[model samples]
Target: MALFEQIRVRLPRGARADAALAGGVFVLVAFPEGKLLGHGGDPLPSRVVSWLLVIVVCGALLFRRRYPVAVGWFTVVGTGAYYVLSDVDGPLVLVPIVALYAIAAQGRMQAAIAMAAAMVIGVGAATLTTASDVTGTAVFMLTGWLVAVVALGSGRHGRLAYAEEEARLRATEERLRIARELHDVIGHNISMINVQSGAALHRLKKDPAQAEAALSAIKAGSRDTLQELRATLDVLRRVDEDAPRAPTPGLARVDTLVGSANLAGLAVRIERTGAERALPARVDLAAYRIVQESLTNVARHSGAGHVTIRLAYGDRELTVAVEDDGRMTARPARPGGGSGIAGMTERARALGGELAAGPRPEGGFVVRARLPYGITGERWSGAADDQGPAGG
Candidate 1:
């Protein structure tokens, strides 16, 4: 088997040479009487013609691999002619067998079968005409050549199957990797914004001056978050030339997001807990989207008068929760009921995190998500607050 594998590897460049050498050897061995110089006890022109036939048969063997179908037919004709003219069993007769196997391996099964049939008919006719004892030779050659074609074809198909399976596995792995990165970028940002926005609102009643500054900070933070998201999305979209340019929103932008809801006459509140820390880009992005999608759902379905968003960071994970105090009966059915929920679930699942969204026991609807910190053990620290809130 190892020797056969080595020969198969070398066959691409060496097949033609091998065929020529084998035919030369056959000619020398078959015409041991010095090319039949004399016939019926005297020299004749037929002797020279017979030698020429051997040369033609050997020459035809050189082109088999480059054009296997043509070579098979040429060999069939040449071998039959040589068998009749020279009364010789030349090695050129095996050319069609190799050519048929090549054709079948290359997915040309019908052509290979046709050539095999031609070989059988030609060999049978030549054997009958010459009255030679070729019955065993003919049977062995036909059966062996057919088996070789079937084996080669099956091997080629198996190789293709393996290649396809490998490609599929690679594609699946890539998708999982991308999903993890996306979760890290989006999750952390949304948590931070939700926290800060809630703090700003709480301080509004106590100090109007600080409230104005906080609102301004919120707008700037939201804008910055959107820009950063756009940049990250651009990198992910490298494979798509026509992908749209849309910025991603992060948690720092929750105030502006909630403000928009306020403008639409929905009362929204945001709150945060724990010491604020800078998160990886993926976590920030996921956090922002969770809040954003939650608020969007509230606007679309709920006739809620108030919505509350909360963000909390523990030692190992970040959690986000959004709830509304709207009456369930007042909420309308979502235009496409399950699509938004499915999309949200898919987004959360991609990040290697968990999301929960449904009606709250007290009243209204709720969305909760928890994302793990320390992606692959990479720790993220808080950035300096020197820049404006919009500079994330």
Candidate 2:
């Protein structure tokens, strides 16, 4: 079956090829031994009529894809007429087999089955002809061949449907990924801006200097937000020739993020260990967003005095951990749905990684993710793990 599928895949998938193939089948079936069916029949008129019927039956097959059921039934009726009239059996079997296959492939299973049964009965009916030499064994062989052709056509139809479904699934996943990117970029930056502007409003009259600083921070954050928005929206700008794209933020910008968090009243410390190595673009982006979302959660939910962000580079993996000395309320989600952590989890799994986010053993919340560097490599310990790196 696999070998047959490979051959079918390699065949030219075009109307021209199908027409040529049908024409070839017609030649072989209509002109056996340089003469039409019943080559030595006493009645030349009957033989000519039989040959014309075979030609007409095979001719309908050229439009099998467009009108499968119509052509299939036409071929079946024409072949039946020829077999009843012609003295010789000829190669009438090929026409109905091809036609039934086309009908079944077009999702007309009932019609194809009915036609196949009719052809079998037609074979039995032809036995009444004095010139027709169709034996019981010959009828059985033709019937079995017809059944196989229907089965093959059904298989081909199923494969085509499966391929289309897979394409739709891919398109859905792409849309979801784009939505996640938009949410992460906009949510994180806007949260910081909201906190800063609120501070500015609260201290505007009492301390103009502090208010001015907060407003300046909001301005900077908004500019960063616009750049990140442009980067996020680039996925939808593939068709735009004039769309300008910005660099995507990665771990290199973690320090910038820490600075922004500090300005938003969260004291965050960054710790880096292990030799840094280049990461794939997806891995880099995932790592950055995970940390960003984690910190945003901390700023919003965690009432911790200080937070620690750790970046660990290992031989086979890279890990990032964000732990805040905050307490979780009864509410299970952030401002929006619980999609923040869910998105981070999806990103890690997409890269063949795992994420852990929960309350720490001590008294705070921790979010840690471990992303592998290569396809075939040992797993590495997460940043919050106490058992050291994997393979150590």
Candidate 3:
């Protein structure tokens, strides 16, 4: 196998390579160094005719990849003609076998099988016509060789198809990841900027002092948006490994979210339960994004006065719930709403977690997510219903 790989690496590629290979094969069969294997009979034709037949049989291989099935049949019939015309039964037989493999490798299984069958039948008929002692064992061995060649070629085709499919799936997953990141980065900051700008416009004439403060907050929010946007784009444009990278958002930066929510006119409070411990990076990022998206939705839709964010760190999982004590405004969702709770749910589910968002019976809406540390083998042992505000 190592020698084969070395040869493959050194070989020329594409159509010219096939032409060179065909020429080499023709030379090996036509002018072998050793005596040629004969069919133990008197030659029935001229030596020139035999060489012409050899050329026709071996020359068909140059177009094997482009016209595999046609070349396969031509080589099969040509090999039989060569054996019948000349007493020589040499490496000329290898050309048809190579053509059969090419047919199978091009994903033409039925054509390869039919060709094999024809070749087997032709050989069996020739054994009957000639007085040679060709045994059943020889015929079976030839069939086995044909079967193995077809299997190898088909396996190569299957592996190539599987690699293509895997590449396509990875590309799709990357696209989805980029979409989610852009949505989270741009959606939240833009929501905050929109709210602050509205407040600034409303208070511009009645109270210029309050208007100035709102304008300042808007300016700051827009600047932060630009910085975060640049950071996100830098991550996407990662062409060099040694380049500086901003830290990914995680629960450690939840304070920044709270401060942003405070500026959005909602009093935000954070409560932690259970023993605080370090979380896996995926779980940490998922938890942060869930909370970030929930806060953005609350600021946009719910006219709430106070919001409570509860974080429960369990032995194997983490629960994050954002509840508000505000009026639940039944606003119709706009087309292509990025700040809705669906994106949060998708994030949680991607981490082997679940999220629930609904209007609480007591007051405003609530979003609860349960994220697991490891998403394999063991199932989550925590109580399933504890993801709500009442339990967590």
Candidate 4:
């Protein structure tokens, strides 16, 4: 058995498999058909014609996948010719059944049904005029076999279609995830660098020391951005084992965001309530991205001088909120204006959580999110309207 398996494994797939199938079917049908015809008093000339017809029917199977309906009709016609010329029942009928299966597997159910009907009717009609012993039971049994073959092929087609769709969805989700990660990683640092560079230029002439400090902050922010960028890109090159690895950003790195926000001239404060404990990786990352994107929006759009970052750990969930005492501006809407809020909300919801981003009732803008412990929940009806003035 093991040696047989080794030989099977070495056999090429696809067309080669079809060729082997045709050869096997020819051997099974041609040999038995010749003996049956000879035993039934068929002359040598008639037997030779019967063998050639069998060869033609079996050989048509080689192109079953490429031209399933065409091959099916050819085999059906060839089988009918074989029956008309010879008086013996033979296994050549199985070839057209195989062709029917191939047609159904190619998602041609209409053609398969039509061919099956034709064959059944043809056989029934042949039994009336021919001297053969085909009975009603035999015709019914053939119908059952044909139905089973078509059903199996159709089932295989459905399964393959479903799997392909699932693969496409997974690919789309992965792309969106990567895009969100890149945006969060680069947007915050770039905002900080932009502010720091402006500060450095403004102070370059007056206070050289302050300008030097601003330049140093820009350098630090640039370095952090590059490192984070590398880490994010490393995930895409999953084949590289020796790539420089950095810890994935999570709630543990909230302080880094606070520091960057401070460098951008926003006085940032972090407040935590309830019991603090380790969180699932997905929750940790989602919370971190929410905070990071909030700070980015504040720096870019909100003219807020003070921002508060809040984290409240509950019994079953974690709440992350960022509020800023910033002025609201009637900024003209642009393409991709609120992508940050959308991404943050998607991240929260993907982990069975919810997020809300809108203006605080009293004044400034606020972005809040709730992440659950379990990774399953009903979807929230949060929309893009939840995006506030600070939306990036």
Candidate 5:
């Protein structure tokens, strides 16, 4: 069985070789039978013609793989003609039967079926007219043809189904990858913006100056964040339409970000060191988010009276530390407690960076991040001087 399966898996050389070999074997076997024509009250010339026809019919099998339908028709016609010419049973009939099976297995079902029906009718007509044992021939021809049709159809259907299932799985995996990227990009910025906006609104009336400042900070953060997000999304979208045009916020926006926090009532002070060379897009976005989220946390969780943002740009790395003087005892419970920190950590790790957030030894919360600046040295040169209003 295993040996047969191996042989079945191999590709055929083509119809010509197949036809020649099969015809040669049938001719060699049927050659001696020419004498039976005169002894059995058979027409000697008709029997000789049938033997030659069998040899000719063998060629039909050769073309079966390349043109199964045409081969099947040739086999049916040759076998039918042989049946009318001779009383002898020869290997000629089996050639077309194999062709019929090939048609059912590899050709379209409608074509296979139509050819199969014709084969059945032709074989049945031949068997009834010439063969002595009509009963056995009738049953074998019909049953074998039907079996071939069913087996071939089933195999083709199974292969098509497996291909479709594989395609579906691949598409599902791609969609999941896109979804994860979108969440990481959009979720982090929107959360920080929401937290900061809430803080700004809460402190608005009591300290109008701080409230206006918070509002302004909210506006600027949202505008830049939205622009940055749109730019990132544009990369993912197809190029059928015009690409979205929105500037991304980089390290240069840190001053405006800190100024907004100052206006929101969190007295923010910023210190920068090193030549502010351009950074990679990813690193720039990461640095911006780290500052935004850290300040948001200070405003929302740290009961700090003041916050400080310290940025150090080195040749190979960029570092940011946000420390606040808020009292831990007076800090309100964070909504969805601590998941935000985990999300921030994930964001940092994605860029081969690190984030440290904890209660400071000096009695407040501190968020620090270290981002490698290796390849991202291009300074983002488009920071606008006019800080936008805070988003609602």
Candidate 6:
């Protein structure tokens, strides 16, 4: 049992292993088949040619994967030739059956069917009159075996195709998610710097100190943007690097985010409605991002004087809401469209949550996201809306 276990550990998986194991059985069975046919006036030949042909057919099957069609045809044609010349039963049936199965498993349906046809015709031409009923019985078995192999092979081929397609789809979705993260991280901060720089340039002569302040803000914003950008791009690295890494910002850093927006010239107030708790890394990151992106939209598009950032913890969900009383500016330039709303939606959906963003009927726009936490806040609390117009 130990020896068998050791051998089993080295076995290859799937169809290749199946072919190898079946090939061994066929080779061993060949000797008995030849001996059984060697009787009376129609004795099997003991010539060197007979053994060589059997070995050739068996050996050819080893390379079935690399050259499936060629190996299949060789085995089928070799079996026919051996029968015609030797007049003795051979393990030719197993050889062709195994070859056809390998061919179909390799997604060569046309070649497998063609090989089956050739085998039928070859058997008729070689054995019909000389062997009579034995020929019909062998052909009947071969016909049924070929049909089974084709069915099995076709199923295997389809499963592999589906698995490949699933892998490709997952990769595409990951790329889209990363793109959205980069856009939210870089786009908002860069846009803020652009606005600050323009303000500094306009106020340089009139208020040197104010211009200096704006420049200082731009410098600080640019630095933080680069740091977060580094963290985001770390995922794209193909080789190990020696650079230091930083922890990803989460709900813990919303204070710093609000401070940054305040510097970007948006007056803001934060509301924490429940006892704070640690969140799963992904949920935490998503929460921070939704807030950051909401404020970014306010800075770029909402002309409201004041904004509110609200974090409401719930028993099974955490809600992050950002609202402003500012007028909604025209849609900004977003690469994947819908002005960062779609990107935020994707993030929430990925985590089995949902997000909603639209203008409130009374006035200002709102962005609210609800993410599952399974621990936090009130049992049935929903995302908090602005009590009235935020900080009006």
Give the best candidate by lDDT.
4
Give one digit per residue, the lDDT tens place, for model 4 in 221-331.
Answer: 888777767666655676525533445567897888888777777899999999999987667777887998888888878889999999999999999999998886322
Q: Residue by residue across 207-295, what tens digits does model 2's lDDT show?
A: 99988988998998888777666655554656636433345557777888788788777889988899988876566777888988888
Q: What CA RMSD would you report for each candidate?
A: 11.3, 7.8, 6.3, 5.3, 14.6, 7.8
lDDT of 5 by residue, 1-392 (tens): 99898788554457555766566656654655554554667666766787678767775566666776787788778877776666776555566656666666563677767766776666566567753466766668676867666577658767877888987975675453344334433444455566667766787777676566666666766775676555555555645555334345466767766665565556888888988878876677667767766776666666677888888889888888888888873334345443445655654665667888888776888888888865333222111111111111
TM-score of each: 0.46, 0.74, 0.85, 0.88, 0.45, 0.73
CA lDDT, candidate 3, residue 320: 98
Find the candidate with the highest TM-score and give its number.
4
Displacement of the residue 38 alpha carbon in candidate 6, Å:
12
lDDT of all predictions = 0.62, 0.75, 0.76, 0.79, 0.63, 0.73
Poorest 10 consecutive residues by lDDT, candidate 6 = 383-392
Candidate 6 clash pair list:
38-44, 304-326, 313-377, 314-376
Clash totals, every prediction: 28, 0, 0, 0, 17, 4
Q: Which regions in candidate 1 have their CA more than 4 angstroms from the true location? A: 1-248, 329-333, 336-338, 374-392
Higher-lDDT candidate among 3 and 6? 3
- Which ten residues in a row are the worst by lDDT in model 3? 383-392
**Stretches of candidate 2 above 4 Å error?**
1-67, 86-94, 107-114, 128-130, 135-148, 239-248, 280-282, 327-331, 335-338, 375-392
lDDT over C-alpha atoms for residue 204 of model 2: 92
| TM-score, cand. 4 vs. native | 0.88
* Model 1 CA RMSD to the hidden true structure, in angstroms: 11.3
Error of 1 at 378 (Å): 20
**Model 3 scores what on Cα lDDT?**
0.76
Report lDDT (Cα) of residue 325, candidate 3.
78
